[model samples]
Every structure is written in C-alpha cells, then in structure tokens.
Target chain A: AQSVTQPDIHITVSEGASLELRCNYSYGATPYLFWYVQSPGQGLQLLLKYFSGDTLVQGIKGFEAEFKRSQSSFNLRKPSVHWSDAAEYFCAVVASGTASKLTFGTGTRLQVTL
Target chain B: DTAVSQTPKYLVTQMGNDKSIKCEQNLGHDTMYWYKQDSKKFLKIMFSYNNKELIINETVPNRFSPKSPDKAHLNLHINSLELGDSAVYFCASSPFDRNTEAFFGQGTRLTVV
Candidate 1:
C-alpha cells in the first residue's frame, strides 16, 4: 500500500526565515507526488507537484520541493516564508497516473511569527 | 467565483436522522470525490465518481451512499447517522485524473447530536 509520513506535526518559524517541511513516502514504484496548503476554514490549494522532472520543482508563492528518489522524500522548501504562509501542509502520493487515488500524510501545521 | 462549492456548511442533526450534503463544481472536471476527516485529523477517501460513473468506492459503510447526477455534481447521503458520523466532509474535483491537483470545497461540518 502507498502511504505518506510527515514526522513534524507542527512547526513554528519567524518571518523571513527559511522553511523546510519534510515528507516521506512508501510506494512500490515511482508515484505522482504533490504538496498542498490549506488555511483554517478554507479549502486546499496546490503548492507544487513532482512527476518526472529535474528533481527540483518550483511552485506558487515561492514554494519549491525536491524529489529525492533515493530517499523516497519530497520535502517542501521556501527561501523566505511570509506571514500568510502560515497554514497546514499536506504531502500526497498517487499509485500511478492512471490509478489516481491520492494517499495523504497526517499534515503539518506551520505557524509564522514576527 | 468558487471552483468547487458545497451547500449547508454546518449541519446539526439527531443521531438517527438522515441527511444529505450537496456538492457541485463548475470547473467542468470529469472526476469528483468525497473525503472524510475524522476528529483525529486523519483524512480518508470514501468515494469517487468520474463522468457520473462510480470509479472508486472505499471500505465505507453501505449507509453512506454517494450519488453523482452529472459530470459536475456529486452528493453524499448518509443513512441512520451515528455518533461516529460527526466529522468534516470535503468535496473535490479533478480535471483529468488524480495526477493533477484536485480542487476542493470549503467543507461541511456534520454534527450528530
């Protein structure tokens, strides 16, 4: 079974600080990976995705994630996080392009402080 | 404009009462889904429909019925609601398949008294 694990349940960082949210997946083969953000009482918004690429994928709001095949990880990173970036982050993996059912992680709640 | 929307954002009902939550998407996507988020914050997929056809049905109770009228609308009807039925239900739609990012609704909070 495909599964995703996010060790950090919650994280606190100061404004303008670099941020890194870790994500790991267990799958039989290379699967479609994605990162999404959700604000309180709001729906989820796609942050980034990785399929077949240069390993480093860039996304909206200055967010980026690197696909480390060896490590089975797709960790999200941002050079500088804005206050508006405070939200819950989720990492997901689909079995394949055709069997597109996503398995999501528990989620990481990010808190940005001044 | 809301891409995906669900009606009755908050629902409070009795344990034995039956209720249905409506969902619609204007993105013209071919696939729609229903997910449940438990009190422990664990999100799980319950049902999925593609072009009004049932595609994926997880290990959900038969009391939970999902109906898709068209390619853009999917509704969830719960029968004989129980205390465990109290959770946040999310509706989502995707264009081609799950490979693409799935657009989600604001979610509906269902509480069984």
Candidate 2:
C-alpha cells in the first residue's frame, strides 16, 4: 500500500525565516508525489508535484521540495516565509497503477509569526 | 471561474437525517473523487469516479453513496448521518490517465448533530 507520512504536527516560524516540512512515503516502486496547501476553512491548492524528474522541484509561492529516493523523503522548503504563508500543508502520493487514488499525510499546520 | 465547486459550503443537520453534497468541475477532467478530511486534518479517499464509472471505492460504509452524473460532476449522498460523519468533504478532479495533480474544490463542511 502507498502511504505518506508528515512528521511535524505543527510548526512556528518568524517572518522571513526559512521553513522545512518533512514528508516520507512508502511504496513499492517509484511513485508520484505532490504538495498541497490549505488555508483555514478552505480547500486544498496544489503547490508542486514530482514525477520522474530532477530531484529538486519548484512550486508556486516561492516553495520547493526535494525528493530523496534513498531516504524515501520529499521535504518542502522555503528560504523566506511570509506571514500570509501560514497554512496547513499536506504531502500525498498517488497509488500505483490506473486507480489514481491519492494517499495523503496527516498534514502539518504552519504558523508564521510577524 | 472556479475549476471545481461544491454546493452548501456549510451544512448542519441532525443525526439520522440524510443529506447530499453536490460537486462539479469545469476543468474537463475525466476523473472525479471524493475525499473526507477529519477533524485532525487527515484526508482519506472516499470514492473515485472516472467518466461516470465507479473506479475506486474505499472502505466507506454502505450508508454513503457516490453518484457521478457525468465526467464533470460527482455527488456524495449519505444516509443515516451520524455525528462521526461530521467533517470537511473535498471534491477533486484530475486527468484520467496521467493522474499527477488534482484540483480541489473549496470543500463542504458537514456537521451532524
């Protein structure tokens, strides 16, 4: 079974500080990965995705994630986080085959302090 | 225009009452899905429809039924709603074959009293 794990439950960071959110996945073969952000009471918005490509993938809103096959990790990073960047982040992996189901992580809530 | 939209952004009803959440996507995607986000923000796939065909049905209860009138719409109907059913339900759509990124709706918050 394909699964995604986001270790951090919540994180607090000052404005303009660097941010890193950890994500790990378990799958038999190489899997498709994605990062999504959701604001309070809102739906999810796709930040970035990783298929078979360069390990470093850039996403919207000055966000990026690096996929490490050895560690089974896809960690999201940002050099400078703005206060408006505070939101919930989810890491997901698409199940193998044509089923096209997405297995999502528990999500990490980010709190940006001004 | 919204890529995906769900009706009744907020719903509050009593237990045993049946309710339906309607979803539509204008993105011309062939696949639509229903996901449930619990209080703890854990999202789980509930059902998936491709071109109006049921493709992925999770371990959801029989009381929950998903209907896809077409490739652009998928609706979720729940019978005998329980307090446990209270959560945010998200509707999403993606291309049928590639299945990389999925566009999600604003979500419908269901509250069962």
Candidate 3:
C-alpha cells in the first residue's frame, strides 16, 4: 500500500530557531512529492513540489525540503522559524501517471513560540 | 481572485438529509478533486476528475456522488447524511499530467446533527 507518514503530530520551535519536519513515503513508482501549508480557518496553499531533477527544492515563506530517495524521506527545513510560520504542514505524494490523485500524510502542526 | 472556490463555506444539516457542495476552479486546469479532512485532520482523496471524466474513485460510500459539468468544475453530493459524514470537504485542481501542484479551495465545513 502507498502511504505518507509525518512522524511528529505537533512540533514547537522558538522564534529564530532552525526547524525540520520529517516525512516518509511508500510508493511503487517514481513519486511526485509536494508540501502544503494550512493556516487557521484557511485553505491549503502549495509550498513546493519535487518531481525530478535536484533533490533539494525551495518553497515560499523561506521554506525548503530535500528529497532523499534512499531513506524514502522528503523532510522540510528552515533556517529560522518565524511566529507566522506556525501552521499545519502536510506532505503529499502521487504515483507517476496516477492522474493527480494525491495521497496525503497525517500532517504536522508547527507551533512557533516567541 | 481565488484560483479555486467551494460554495457554502459552512453547512449544518440534519441526519438523513441530502446536501451538495459545489466547486469551481479558474486556473484552466484539466483535473479536479475532492478531499475529506476528518476531525483528526487527516486528509484523504475521495474522487478525481480529469477533463470532466471520472479518473479516480477511492473507497468512499455510495451515498457520496461527484459530478463534473466541465473541466473546471466538480461537485459533490451526499445522500442520507450521517454523523460520521461531518467533516471539512476541500476541492482542489491541478494541471493535466505529471509534476502538477494542486490549488485548493477554502473548504466547506459540514456538520451533521
């Protein structure tokens, strides 16, 4: 079965601290990876995606993620956390040629503390 | 302007009542989808339509039906609503084929009484 996992249900980081959110996925074929952010009472917004080429991808709001094929991980990272960065982050995947049916992880809620 | 929009941002209905949620995307994308976000905040795909044709249907109840009048619109209708059916329904759209990122609507919160 294909699935995505976000090990941490919630994470807290003080403002200006480095942050990392872990994600792992199980898929049969080459995977199309994505990260989305959702704020309170708001819709999901695409942060970044990994399809091919470079393993490291940069996203909006100074966020970036690296795709590690060996470990089946695509962890999100940021050099410094901001209070506004506190939101629910989701990792999603779709099998190649699957017609955009995304398999989403359980999501990680980031709580930034000042 | 919203790239994707879903009508009835909040809906509260009685059990066994039928209701529908409409979705529209103006990004000129070829694919649309409906996702359910449960109380636990787990998001799951319910249906996918590409070019107004049903492409993917997950293990959803038969009471839930999705309709696509065009490539830019997808609508979901539920019959005989139940308590477990109360959830946040999100509509999203993406471009056709590989390496596409989906745009999501504000989501509709459904409550069953």
Give a tens-digit lDDT track for model 2, residues B1-113.
99999998999999999999999999999999999999999999999999999999898999999999889999999999999999999999999865468999999999999
Fnat per model, in the order shown:
0.49, 0.69, 0.86
Which candidate's lDDT is highest?
Answer: 2
> Which lDDT value does model 3 have at B73?
91
lDDT of 1 by residue, A3-85 (tens): 99999999999999999999999999877899989898777888999888689999999999999999999999999999999
Model 1 / residue A66 / CA error / Å: 0.5
Flag clash pairs in model 1: none
User: How many pairs of residues collide in model 1?
Assistant: 0
> Highest DockQ among the candidates is held by which one?
3
TM-scores for all candidates?
0.96, 0.98, 0.97
Give the CAPRI class of candidate 1.
medium
Comparing 1 and 2 on DockQ, the stronger one = 2
Considering every candidate listed, which one attains the maximal TM-score? Answer: 2
Candidate 2 per-residue lDDT over residues A26-100, each given as its tens digit: 999988999999999899999999998699999999999999999999999999999999999999999976866
Candidate 2 has which clashing residue pairs, if any? none
- lDDT against true structure, model 2: 0.95
